[model samples]
Target: MVFDAPPATASHSWMPSSPCGPACIEPIDEIGTARTLARLAGVIGLVLSFPVLTAATPKARREHMQRRYARTALRCLGLRLRIVDHRHEPVDGFAAPDTGVLVVAGHIGWADVLALAAVQPVGFVARADMVDWPVLGTLAKLTRVIPIERARLRELPGVVDRIARRLADGQRVAVFPEGTTWCGRAYGSLRPALFQAAIDTATPVQPVRLRYLDGDGNPCTVPAFVGTDTFGDSARRVLRSKGMTVEIVLEPRQWPGTDRRDLARRCADAVRGTDPSRHGLLDTEWIAAGSTRVQDPSVGERGPIRRTVMATRW
Candidate 1:
């Protein structure tokens, strides 16, 4: 199913002011056609394999198939995924190969879902409206996804509780605390309310950043699945193009120690440091946590992040 349009200011397709400028219209149209065919083929394949996956025990085969499906879909779109700075990335503290986890990450684009799924057997919290989408909705449910209504924030506790139970039983889950997708420049202040489970169980939170590089190696506007971005057009644009690199950057897991808000702040701070931008995306107050200045003898880099954002939240 095609996603809705992203917000106007956040649009990925920018029209040049000069009318005579080269048009990407033709390429976009062609890509859209290819995307349509791939989506149909994907749906058919999923239906055909359903019974076989259901019958398989231990499900390693089924899970690997899911990863393959995601990989194939991305490849058909001409999108390449690159992982960076993961050498020292720590494993999820409570994540057993068969168990579940609460993976809290930054939301930037639709690619994130596919990229994350390609790594492990996991689930996501999607909007209730997504359940109405044609093939995509059905496939999402098949992946053990749980849908939530955006209007009903009060039901969050019950929803998260259900997810926690799944995690306790060994199913990894991902949540975007920004509550929405955005350009990968900075992290939005996380909603403390959704972080209750970490506080309650001291569960580890995985912080990730998604960066989309253009053909020229510049940061491109990622296609968010929601908001005003046109899903069909965006899907076509991404699928047909080559030279784009989407990175699924996974960082070490953060353990619960302080207050809920403080934990959220630290997670956000750690994620912000990963931005390719020279200045970290964190607020000034956040940067003030330690000796904010130093005559650096080092080659090139901001002085160490001595102050901790977690301390300020209190």
Candidate 2:
């Protein structure tokens, strides 16, 4: 499960690039205090509902509640979400899904977790240190998110084992394989380490690209929780922005037996929005990430997102 010829930095790596794409903007538009209270109320409600949710006998009932709560919670935060599915095989919304599927999404800000939770009712793989955060930490523990000690290389396998078990049991597990956040302008490689978990469990890998757009339809710059960016600063940025739209572009799923390196490459390319023909990244580099911004999608009315490129087969 070595993800690269070299290796990735620790999970707590803090690299931030100021997005200079046409889609990025300045001037945070402050939100009213009432909206913030609404989100707080939503969080409180979730905390109160946990006992009943956990005690529910039916798994499907629990999942239904999770999705409902996530969506409502995002609304209270004044964020709108739109999901564009490009999967050849669409998943049944409320079906009791089989195990062995993993979601590898681009990491941008703390909101990535919240957004994905609303879109897909699945547990997440987060940093081990997050378990100490006040409210968020409690939610992650209650929701059964697997935590990885980013700096401890020896511990990755153990974390992956937990992920494998979750997948083997028919649950979808999400991971931010970038190992950290990036400028929304371009995507970095998917860490190869986690891909091993999928291969071992015979799990399918689904790639997703998450981006935040402002009221004017530009890349929302304020929400990125990157290097040295404090939680209060990021939260204020999101609250001050007039409108924040989270676009989730779901790519095709790579089935079991597909080479782990190949899976990492395609996912990296999709997240970067690179044309496959370009072969821009080396295989070694695909698993080991580096930061750089390559294009501006907002310059002109861009066409369909390459990540969500459609297919006729799974």
Which candidate leads the pack in TM-score?
2
| Residue-level lDDT tens digits of model 1 in 22-115 | 1112121224566657755764576566546656745666766666676765665566777554426454322557655577777665667777
lDDT of 2 by residue, 213-309 (tens): 8788876656665544555556556654667788888877776475777777777766666522111122222211243333334444544322321
For model 2, the stretches where C-alpha displacement exceeds 4 angstroms are 1-25, 52-58, 93-96, 256-258, 275-314
What lDDT is reached at residue 219 by model 1? 61
Against the true structure, what is each candidate's TM-score? 0.70, 0.76
lDDT of candidate 2 at residue 294, scale 0 to 100: 31
In model 1, the runs with Cα more than 4 Å from the true position are 1-58, 85-94, 274-314
Clashes of each: 15, 5
* Residue pairs with backbone atoms closer than 3 Å in model 2 (clashes): 3-192, 23-219, 29-240, 30-240, 99-170
